[model samples]
Target chain A: MATTEAARPIAVATTPHRRTRWRHVLTGSVVPRVILIVSCLVFLAPFYWMVVSALKTNTELAQFPPSLIPGAWAFNNFPDAINYIPFGLYTFNSLVITVGATIGAVLSNTLVAYGFSRIQWPGRNALFYLCVATIFLPYPVILVALFDIFGRLPSFGIQGAKSWVDTFLPLIVPAFFGNPFYIFLMRQFMLGIPKELSDAAKVDGASELQTFWRVILPLTRPAVIVVLILAAVAAWNEFLLPLLYLQSNDKYPLAVGLIFFTSEHDVSYNLLMAASTLIVLPVVIIFLVAQRFFIEGITVGGVKG
Target chain B: MTAAATSVKPRSVGRFRLGTLERRNLKWGLLFISPWAFGFIALGVFPILYTFFLSLTRYTGFRSPTLIGFNNYTTMWNDPDFWKAAYNTLYYTVLAVPIGVVVAMLLAIAMNQKVREVAIYRAIFYLPSILPVFAISFVFVVLLNPGYGLVNLLLTTAGLPSPNWLGDPAYTKLALVMIAQLGAGQWALVFLAGLRGIPIELYESAEIDGAGAFRRFRSITLPLMTPVILYDIIIGLSFGLQVFTSAYILTGGATRGGAGPDNSLLTYVFYLYQQAFQFGSMGYAAALSVVLFLASVILAMAVFRWARGWVFYGGEEA
Candidate 1:
């Protein structure tokens, strides 16, 4: 910031061509502006095509030189798509897992973060390193073992030996444990809170938990919001887990459900795109709503994105 | 409150006993992270160790896993499909990671410019990436559908022959590379974040030295952004090696269990999934994952070694 201004006067004096180029481009530069506009359209075209194709009738969709815009918007494509596939049940199952796991994740990650950050304890650094190390442990390795464990998570009322396969428990239950990335993100965010707030709370006879619950969590709503959206989006888009455990279509998430829809309704581009759009809606909306926080989380959260 | 009355400081006391307050904090700390601690023991530690053990055993889902020695590893070594999957994974990673990073870096630089309403453009660029990975895969399946697909239509109109994307073995991985590049916005944002971090003053100082934009970029922007670029490359490589859903969805894995034409899109994780669940070869899948984990470590070590002098850090050189 100091540099932008300090350098600006010098830049104007030193490079008249550069200043003119900036000014010219700001007004109208055919090449750069064209590139910018074209790239914008390129990014946007897929979405436009998805929406347009979703609304097209099969006849219109079959056209050789496809109409840029659908001649007739089949609004019923959504309903038809939902009816054609078991999207509603799949969506409901996905919702349950997303909400259940998100709630579990937020609570677990925040609580664990508070422990790691606010209250410095013996072996905390070592324990924290242990948590961070899990970030590198590829999901596929643990997945082979997790399947067996989940297979053993005793069936409550169902008959025969327990299997987490074809059930929602495996998908929803792990969020309660704590995700390494979320724990790390929330921990970093919590560490930024001044020590004096917790100190003052301690002096007033508030317990550590009380200080954390009342003082820290509230102050870190932004981080919570970030973690919530990240976790929820992750749950929504998770294909592999839902594909793994949820054997039946009744238990499939949107991600898995959409794939099933595509294969079942092959060549029905309209319906497939419609279903795809619906699956993606929640994630795009959440990111739009909390754009800054989402980006901030990524910046701090590092790569598990 | 009364803990301060104890005439002791942790630093001052060389090897003193644990203070009451320290013990209390420890208790609460343990209590706070108890969920993760239990979970790690149950889930993290158990699963990792069990996976290693399972790799050496014949564990189909229904039957009890029998100790099979190094059979699973040896089987994978001999399997033709395993080699194919490994080769496909390597091909995808080598192709995708570099292109993805460069495209994202360029996009970030362009988006970093002082333009009006650049936020809207940034948001637009980022939307495709943030959209569920499978959704983009679904969309691309439609957009790239050989004959009647929009991509082919455009190509033919321009008098360019459009290859059968998901159909031909030759084009399947290339098609995936294109799909992967389209969603480079996530890393682009990371690069944008890095680009924004570069102080404007550095450019001005360089500009005062009569450096051209290209020279300034090379001298100032490129060096500063190396760390983020390296990070972006590493993340891209990991994801590239693990590529699955795009191939699975695009090829319609449900109807046909094959990845793509002749399994060209069969990545490491994809093959692992197929082996464990579809083929019920859980032990074999475990071995594949063990190889993958080792590969990831080796890859990171290679990149770190490669980055020794190249990746610039601010305070270190100064």
Candidate 2:
């Protein structure tokens, strides 16, 4: 197989120009098409299995030589899965964290990016390098110490809060501080804007913030949207932080809550799959709706790195 | 003053005596970046230092820490479970990173094909990369069930032996590797971008020079992709070392210290979590974390140094 694939290129290269077109169509397209089609099936199979398992009956789920298609489409399983766990409450918690984190990510990253890109200040590049270097610092390195910091938050004189440990603050508040990755993305995008636009706004008697707000921010809409989607998706899929911080069942996001549901309940494969589908549906929809930004953000990050 | 400062280049100004506009710009720049600066200090810097401090103490969550010198590190050095966790983590990283890179590179090449349904194929491949890892883990739990599972059924049909994927110690880490491949699409996208950046003219020129497609790919495409490949490997190494969530979920996390059948699935971070939260040995976990941090930094540095020989920058002579 490998030899043939390698030999085809030589064959095509040496072939007569008129005949080469037919050879290209036959050899070039066929192999790639077959490879891609097989790959597509392999990648999509789990999703198909996930959906089919979600719709299967308990008896059908337990059957040996498991049927490829669900024998019965138990649509009620969706509602049942929701009822089996506090799905509504978990969804609300997930929403609160996702929205809070997304807003914080966009606002903080844009402001920091503006500072790093538009303003020419002493030590700017040095500070930006420090910011970028934080990307390599593994999260576990900070996990224990941050937990201690948050666990001791009440002692530092924040009124009415007992501890930051059990609250959504730990997960959401950090986003307000600016993630290094998002800051990098926003800075790269902001750097591409013509300097004349900000200068014109400044010459019209605008303050730096005003010029940023009026001229630069509007131009950075695409980058902001990219940051927004990435942040929301990240927050939605976050498991470790939530698993560590939120102690109460009521506060658990869908990511952590699903684990609680499975561990506490007897194994119900169908119900679990149904719940998994429900949790994954929103992310799938978000990706479909704003996929361009996701790809743009990823490629930009990859290329820059 | 503002106009004068603007006329003179900011870098050319004296260190202590700044121009009016330069000073103003400095103030606003600091102001704009204050949030991240505060977070960087409070979260990033402070925590790292404190983690080192905590690693030297004997503390539980409820009580104050007592300084214990280097006892925690000595204990970690002697602990067999610690070594086991380290070994398991190394095993996972060594196997998963290279396999993932190859799969991603192949997928990128396939996606770059001129087929009409390429968009659909790209989307299909990339979808699994974005779905929550925990959800994917759960899906695999059923798919790899020893009895009546889809995988086992397929294996039986093919007259092949299907070892218990999750139950057996030998196959547990491999199961996680299989799960890791689901996210290859994410890197595949990155590789796709790299592939796109390679000039088509180079291939055309090579073809006219009687270079086969294989030769063109070997010489022109592979050299150009070295930088991206280096980036992917570094990122993959870090991620591979930090493999926690899937193992945690698969091994039944709520059971407390369930590290999967004789601790075959006890990844480094998972062990750290068990020590810190599950067992309430905060100080010990801090030591584990410090080791992880050092290892990561050292390995990354080693890779970068090693890469000097192979990584081809486009502007440089290869």
Report the CA-based lDDT of candidate 2 relative to the real structure.
0.87
Which tens-of-lDDT digit does each residue in B200-249 have in candidate 1? Answer: 77877787788977898898999998988787776677677778888787
lDDT of 1: 0.80
In angstroms, how far off is B135's CA in candidate 1? 1.6
DockQ of 2: 0.53
Q: Tens-digit lDDT track for model 2 on A1-305?
A: 22233555666668756576666666567888888788888788787888899999888998998999888789998999999899999999999999999999999999999999999999999999999877766788889999999998873433234799888889899999999989999999999999998887776767888888989999999999999988988899999999999887788999998875566546888988999999999999998988888788888885221
Candidate 1 structure quality by residue, lDDT tens digits, A146-235: 898888877674323256667788888889989888999999989999998988887777777789889998999999998898888888
lDDT, candidate 1, at A133: 67
Reference-based lDDT, residue B98, model 1:
91
- Per-candidate Cα lDDT values, in order, are 0.80, 0.87
In Å, residue A176's CA in model 1 sits off its true spot by 1.2
Query: Chain A TM-scores, one per candidate?
Result: 0.87, 0.90
